[model samples]
Target: MRLEGRTAVITGGTRGLGRAIAEAFLAEGASVVAAARNPYDIKELADDHEGRLLYQYTDVTDERSVEELMTAACEAYGGVDILVNNAGVSRDGKIARLSVADWNTTLATNLTGVFLCTRAVIGPMTTPGKPAGPGGRIINVSSCVAGRAAVGAGAYSASKAAVEMFTRTSAVELAPKNIRVNCLSPGYIDEGMGKELAANERAWESYRGRLLSDRLGRPEEVGAAAVFLAGGESSYVNGTVVEVNGGLLWAA
Candidate 1:
């Protein structure tokens, strides 16, 4: 119960890495609000965790929707002590083939959403008198591809690279407010996008050699890293990008 009594708001917490992080936080005794455009069977999670979990419909790209999410979280669990900007979308296409729409959508969700959600949570997390305890935590989710170049990952990679820089900037600005911000850059995992990639034998074989572990990472592994970042264990850690990859070797 490292997170006992803490309140966390996770964007896109209904599935994939976000869902895994939600479950991990709940296990550590945190009250969580999972925000996404759709519930996507998150009711099952609510049922299992009962009072500890709440699902809110949120479109992170919209400012009003994000404000409502933070407001609702405050009303339900008092105030948010931790925030995870985990919402993202991937529209893979080569530079020449990628459409403006695909690039726009990818940036809107992957980069802009993080900006909005983080901005909205600042006030609540740093309420003058309330003082959310020792301090607040903000975890921005990035991808391993942020620093690696791939054939059809232009938009996704660009958006994520910007996110990592944004994480650093946020950390610097929010440090005075006692808010610690960090980025979690996950490598190919066994679920979500990684699962889709692994399904393609040719793609999997090509990328398999890059992983030092010689296997895809587990969702729980990413979730565990999230827990560490949000918990007291990482009090001194901030403005750093924690790579949860199984040691991916990128070619020059």
Candidate 2:
């Protein structure tokens, strides 16, 4: 196992893309702390992985809860080796009519949560004598919409766009600490949020033809990409956004 003996804290790891990443990490022999606001039927997953998995209640939007998550990881697994900032929310609305509440909600979770989790993990990950492995990794999840134009996706796009820049900045800042920060941007995937979109026949039809692969991406595909970034094989890779979108050809 490439990730044997390492411990990773994954925010929003309860479902969707986050869950996929958690599964991948577990398969690679890493101890995973699946941080999410709700348990969301994770009992079975925890049962399967047993000691390798932990479900911690974390509200990434709140500083206290995020800190507690780190503490929990440290207590349960000795220290944090990798962090996947996969927690996010999307609020769709045209620019003019978007409510302030919606905008704030989007930014608070998508942007601020990434910041909080990244900052909180620094202590545990870098602390001496507490590492499960060569500890230092952070993966931020963004979306293709961040760089493209999508009608009624102003707030959502803007928040993710900000995350991409944040990822770059964090990579530079955390370099001296030996932490490699990177971004994973997935396009139309048939899971979680993407699944919801693909459910809309009209929307799916429009997006389907634009994809070079001509099909929705699978969750395991995104999981595989995450595995590369978290593993030692990508030791030289950092501060880059790896697109997991099945060759999505979208300008808007």
**Candidate number with greatest TM-score:** 1
Question: For model 2, which pairs clash?
Answer: none
- Backbone clashes for every candidate come to 0, 0
Best by lDDT: 1
Estimated TM-score for each candidate: 0.97, 0.96
Q: Work out how many backbone clashes candidate 1 has.
A: 0
Off by over 4 Å in 2: 130-133, 250-252
Residue range 1-252, candidate 1, lDDT tens digits? 999999999999999999999999999999999999988998998898889999999999999999999999999998999999999998988899899999999999999999999999999988878854769999999999899888899999999999999999999999999999999999999998899989999989998988888899999999999999999999999999999999895422
Task: Quantify all predictions' global Cα lDDT against the true fold.
Answer: 0.94, 0.91
Residue 19 in model 1: lDDT: 96
